[model samples]
Target chain A: MIELHRVSKVYSVGPVKVPALREVSFRIGKGEFVVLTGASGAGKTTLLRLLYRDDLPSEGDVEVLGYGLVQMRRSQVAAFRRSIGVVFQDAKLLPVRTVYENVAFVLRVLGTPRRDITARAFDALRAVGLSARAQAYPAQLSQGEAQRAALARAIVRRPPLLLADEPTGNLDEAMAGEIVDVLKDIGAGGTTIVLATHQARLAVALRRRTLTLEGGRIVKDEG
Target chain B: MLGFLVGEALRDLRRAGRVAVSAVVLITLSLAALGGFWLVSSNLGHAVAKWRDRVRIVVYLKREPPGGDVAALLERVRVMPGVAGVVFIGKADALRALKQVLGKDAGVVDQLPVNPLPASLEVTPSAAAVTPEGARELLARLAVLPEADDVAGSADWVERFSHWQRLLTTIGLGVGFVLAAASILTVTTATTLILHARRHETEIMRLVGASEWTIRLPVLLQGMMQGLAGAILALGALVVTHSVVAPRLEPLVSLTLGLSQLVFFTPVGVVALLGAGTLLGGLGGWLARAAREP
Candidate 1:
């Protein structure tokens, strides 16, 4: 579940104030798949960042998965983040780690028991169809495979909410379609998903609830 | 979790490469300098203790005590506050001692026109009176004796040797502190480099919900490892230097300081040095984390 009420974000770049979002209000219910579509510099990334508590809203409230983003302590941020999954545009996998290690890294960090980590990590990898490439390093993977590995890492702990920011930004149509299908499959399993992408056609093709942004304002919200 | 941290620390150290090595070398140089000075000071302390037990004040008499009066004089000086005992050395006995000291040159002492040696009472001071101040006080008391001509105590030279020992300690500490500061800085720089090298990995870790301690501890451990390695190497160098150099210096030490052997650091001292290195390294790493984040 995600809720943002009258959220406004202004970034300061040396005496100049750049407003990235203005009075945005939205409520996303449980188990909903919402696509966030916008042009470059239209604040899609900023909005997702707020949802995950990476950046606090400048002048409003952001409540994601029961955490009040503006009021959460810095120490509590990590725990809150662990309760949700986030996939960036770039896969951002550790270059030296194998795909399996990358996915298992999250479980290891959370201090999951050794016996449970293997099964859980492999399950997540299988869910993203990256089980066959588990042994490959990030450098060895294709762009699409890297993104799939990132998805596996995100969902490894089976968080209730998943946020993807441009998960298919660099892929071709067929590869992008493959990633979108995987996300759809994940959504079908009852995980609340908020995905940000610049591709409008992709948003229309998915036929999910979509929030369209133009120049830091949500211009349209429709299914 | 501990094993994972140690593994990450070692990996970071390897990633730091030459900067890490330089930090270790700097710590080694600093610790070695400190240990070397400590060795010298410890030996000097032993020599000071040895000689303090043997300190004697000699009161040269204006004239030889009349035969029957010698006993009275000895008894009188014996009861003085710090006088442990008194030995009366007559002129003839003094001449004989001089000839004994002359060894093969005994004929030179016999060639003198008259017995040039003065009769004296050798006063052995108690342990409490062996210090420079105590000896000076005792000498002052004896100088006022009616039969005393010249009074001298061995405390002055012993005090000089003690001064030299303290100076060595102070100098050693000064040098060690400067080198230690440099080593800590070098460790900080090395850790900073590793942090930059692993920035992407760290960001990913943070995003994945790794706690600040989890993200920062490896860097701290890396610094400590560097420090620990340097300390071990420094101790090794010290041991080799001591074994190879102690025997060659013992004869001179025995002649000058009256010590039969040079003493290296005690076990406690060794641990202190190692602990200092580790602490310095840890501090550097902690500072790096503070600077990087804050």
Candidate 2:
């Protein structure tokens, strides 16, 4: 579903050049559950960001869901974004909007029909087992509930690709397992999932492809 | 999308009700500055026009008519810039005009052994001819004539009218400068506030494939609304004040010129004020978005 060819990212902060990813080439087929693992600056987030076009590769080409991301205009970036569901580690919900509204934000931005938006938002909430808390505020939800709400928001559009950056990084073991289960259920439904994690045991049960990085280069690829 | 923007704007206004009120108050005050000066300028124009219509300039011929020079002199003064048209009131015509004005006192005019008044060149200049500056120039040129006497007219009347116009002109310019400054300040504040409220949302919206106008229209619309509301509020207060006080002032100055004569902005004026106010609001939003958009 996503591919990178000789992609490299360089960040110029002050006069110094910091290289995040260097000549990385990889691909994950459709419906695959992949964990990208690395130490602090091993370019895991940079790879994820490149896939989303949040940050472009400084060199070579990157493709996401068949779109030639290098040639994609800024105007078309949002359309590319809509093709994927992204669950952030932070669960960045608008504090002023309600739980349902947070999930509905993407649809509203897309100018989806009002009735469709409400139905999809409700269904997404139900899928995440949060329909009862649909009207509640972010402040009212526990960490697990908030992450669940974030999941609902990410999947509300039924996007083909799901990218979660540290989906369970902030949760306890039980909560982490819950998030993993939710993500797995999504992957089972044919959405290609690429989750970024450093945990040793989290990606073991899934038995899917794993790409391990070290020193800005992929060191291990296991299936 | 419009509904969403309007809803968001209203919600923002509600959440930051104080800021919205401050925006309106600032905008209203700015408009009041413009409206008040406009009213004053309009009234001044009317007063000048009224004074101009009734006023006439008198050009007196020299004491020695140099035999046949009387008609030529009359012709010269008749063609002067401020001179609308001229009437050659010969000695006999002058006596007749005096008799008419004097009415029953016409007998006293006939008692005079000779016509003491000069065979004056009665020049009726346009209202534009009634200014101190214009009149001064006309008199200076007229006096240089060999047949001329010391030129004179209602200097006080011209002076008074011109004085008011100059004062009003200064105030109009000063008010205009103030209004422009206020517009920029208001637009900057409004646009910045709009952007700040939706910075993250805007980015996400863009990332999610929203168009430029889809994001910007709401901000511009909000600005337009702010301007409209402010102008309306200020004008409403002014109208109410006029209704209450103009009637009372009517007894004092019979020739009072005010909003009563205006018919309350003549629709076009109202539209312009509201349109301008709304534009100010929208412009603020546009500027904010535009600055970051490129």
Candidate 3:
């Protein structure tokens, strides 16, 4: 679950003020698949970032999974992060680690038991249809395959919340459709999914509860 | 859990082997610097101990006691403190020894036909009077004696040698400081590189819900490993250096300098050196992690 009440985020670059979110108010319910749509500089990324406690809101309050984002300590951030899966626009897999290790990286970071990390990592790889290529490096995989690996890493912990920032930005149209379909399957399996994007065609196809943003303010919230 | 920590550490080391190597190099340089200081101080101590075996003081004899009453004069020299096994070396013996050293140079021997060398009493000082300054002060007391010409042994040469040794020690300290500073800088730079290369990996780990402790343990272990490896290398270098140099200096000044008695690291000493290396490496890693804003 995600909630924001009159939240605003502003950035100051040498006294030149830039606002990313202007008193935004929204709520994303548990098990709901939501698509956040906006053009560049529309504050979509800032909203998603607030969910994981990455970027704190400048005004008002934001809460995710019942924890106040602004109030959470650094130690608490780790626990919060462990409860959600995130897919950044870049995939951001460790270049030195193999695909399996990258997925296992999160589990290991959480201090998961060795036996469980290996078993779970294998299962997650299989879920992404990457079982055969688990040992491959990120550089060795196709763009779609790497994205799928990233997807496996996100869901490996089985967090109730999943956020993807422009997950299909670098993929072909067909690949984007497939990625969306995969996310739909995850949402069906009871994971709350919040996907952010700029492409109207990709957004239209998801056919989920949608929130549209223009400039720094939300213009529409439609189911 | 220990294995898991070690595994994580090894993975980080393997991933960033070059950075790890650089850190180790820094650790080793520091170890070597401190080790060198210990080696010099200990070697000097050993040499001084050996010199103590031949510790002696020279007391010039009175003018043969005009009455030829040699008994009282020699007796007085014997009663003085630290007169261990005093032996009288008359002018005749002194002349013979001097001739042997200078080689029978005719003109020089003719010029000293009257035998300018004085009859002297060689007194072995107590171990308490082993320091050059100690010997000099005692000799000065002996010289003012109305009966004697001048005290000779354990004089200027000892003081000069000690001064040179102290100068060397000061230089050694300066060198050690430079080496330590260089090492700290090197370790800091290397750690920065390690952090940089893994920045993305760190971001990924954050995404996956890994705890900070889990992510940090490996980096700590890697730093500790680098330090240990560097220390071990330095130890090997010292051992090899001692082994090679000890033999060459044996016959040259073994008696006076006692180079053979120059002992290298004992087990405890080696451990101390290794521990120092580990601490520096571990601390460097800790600083790097602590300074990270992420």
Candidate 4:
């Protein structure tokens, strides 16, 4: 579950106060696949960051998985992050690790048993169609493969909620379609997904609830 | 998890390469400097104890007195508060001892027209009176004796040597402090380098819900390992140096200080040196963790 009421984010650069999100409010039920569409600088990433408690809203409340982000203690925030998977535009895989290790890293952080970790990581990679590339390194992967590896890493822990920020921003149309299909398969497995993207066509093709943002405010919500 | 933490730490050290090596070298230098001074101080203390046990004061008389007068003076010297024992060495006996000391040059001493050495009472001081202050007080009393013209004792040299030892210890402490600081900073620099190199890895770890300690423990272990390696190396260096130099210096040490041989660190000393190295490294890790990210 996710909830935000009248949330606003402001970034102060020098003497200027630049608003990234303005009193944006939204709710998504469990196991929903939701697309967040916005132009560049339209608060999609900011909203996702707020949901994960990466950055707290300047004003208003953000509730994710039953914890209030605005007032959560740092320890609580860390605990809260474990229940959710987040993907940045950059795949952010450790260059030194193989894809299997990268995905296993999430389970390892959770102190999962070594045997369980192998099983879970392989399963996650299989879901993303990356089990064959498990031995490959991040540097050796194509843009699509890297994104898939990042996806496998996120879902390996089987988080209740998944927030992806432009998971296909750098991919070709064909590769992007494949990533969307993989995401759809993940959502079908009942993990709530909130995917942010600047591509309206991707949002339309997914046939999910789409929330469009412009100048820091949500302007449309339709399926 | 313990295995993972330790493995990660070793891997980090390997990744650290030159910076880690620098840290180890710095630690070795610090511990070696400290250990070297410890050895010096220990040997000096042995010398001091040997000399203190043999402390003697000589009251040189103007001339040998008559039989009754000599008996009275010897009795008076024996009754002094700090006099452990007294032996009267007459002029003829002093000359004989001088000839024995001169060894191959005994003929030169005999060529003199008459014996020039004075008759003296060799006063062996009590344990308490062997100290510089106590010896000085005893000398003052002996100097006032009617039969005595001069009172000579080894107290001044003992006092000066003790002072020199203190000075050396103080200097050693000051140098050890500076070197220790440099070693800690070197470890900090190396840990910081590892932190920077693995910043991305750290962020990923945090995202995957790693505890703060889980992320930090490896870095701390790496620092400690560097320190430990350095201490072992320093101990090895000290052993080699002592072996190579102790034999050459044994004669001089024996001749001057009455010590048969110079020795390396004791078992306790070795443990302390190693422990200090480990502590310095841990301190560096703590400092690195405490510093804010720029």
Q: Is candidate 3 or 4 superior in DockQ?
A: 3
Off by over 4 Å in 4: B57-130, B138-154, B292-294
CA shift of B173, model 2, Å = 3.6
lDDT of 2: 0.76
Quality of candidate 4's docking, in CAPRI categories? acceptable
**Model 1 DockQ vs. reference:** 0.61
Model 3 error, position B82 (Å):
10
What is the TM-score (0 to 1) of candidate 1?
0.90
Error of 3 at B138 (Å): 5.9
Against the hidden true structure, what lDDT does model 1 obtain?
Answer: 0.92
What's the lDDT for residue B128 in model 4?
77
In model 3, the runs with Cα more than 4 Å from the true position are: B1-37, B52-162, B209-217, B258-260, B280-294
lDDT of 3 by residue, A1-223 (tens): 7998999999999989899999899999899999999997898898889888888888989889889888888778877887888897788887878999988877777778888998999988887788899999999998888898999999999989999999998999988877887888888899999999998788888888899988879899987
After superposition, candidate 1 runs with Cα above 4 Å error: B60-121, B126-131, B146-150
Task: Kindly indicate the candidate among 1 and 4 with the higher lDDT.
Answer: 1
Docking class of 3: acceptable
Candidates' TM-scores? 0.90, 0.81, 0.78, 0.84
lDDT of 4: 0.89
**Model 2 agreement with the true structure over A61-163: per-residue lDDT tens digits:** 9888899999999878777888988877888777778899988987886788887999999999988889999899999998888999999988998999988
Question: What tens digits encode model 2's per-residue C-alpha lDDT throughout B1-294?
Answer: 667767766655554455556667777777777766676566666666666665665667666465487677777776767777766667777878889999988899878998898866666666666777776776676667676565666445746865777788778668756775676566557667767877767765665556666677766666667767887887887678667765676554445532234323557877777776776666665676677665
Candidates sorted by lDDT, best first: 1, 4, 3, 2
* Clash list (residue pairs), candidate 4: none
Model 3 error, position B51 (Å): 2.9
Q: How far is B135's C-alpha from truth in model 3 (Å)?
A: 5.0
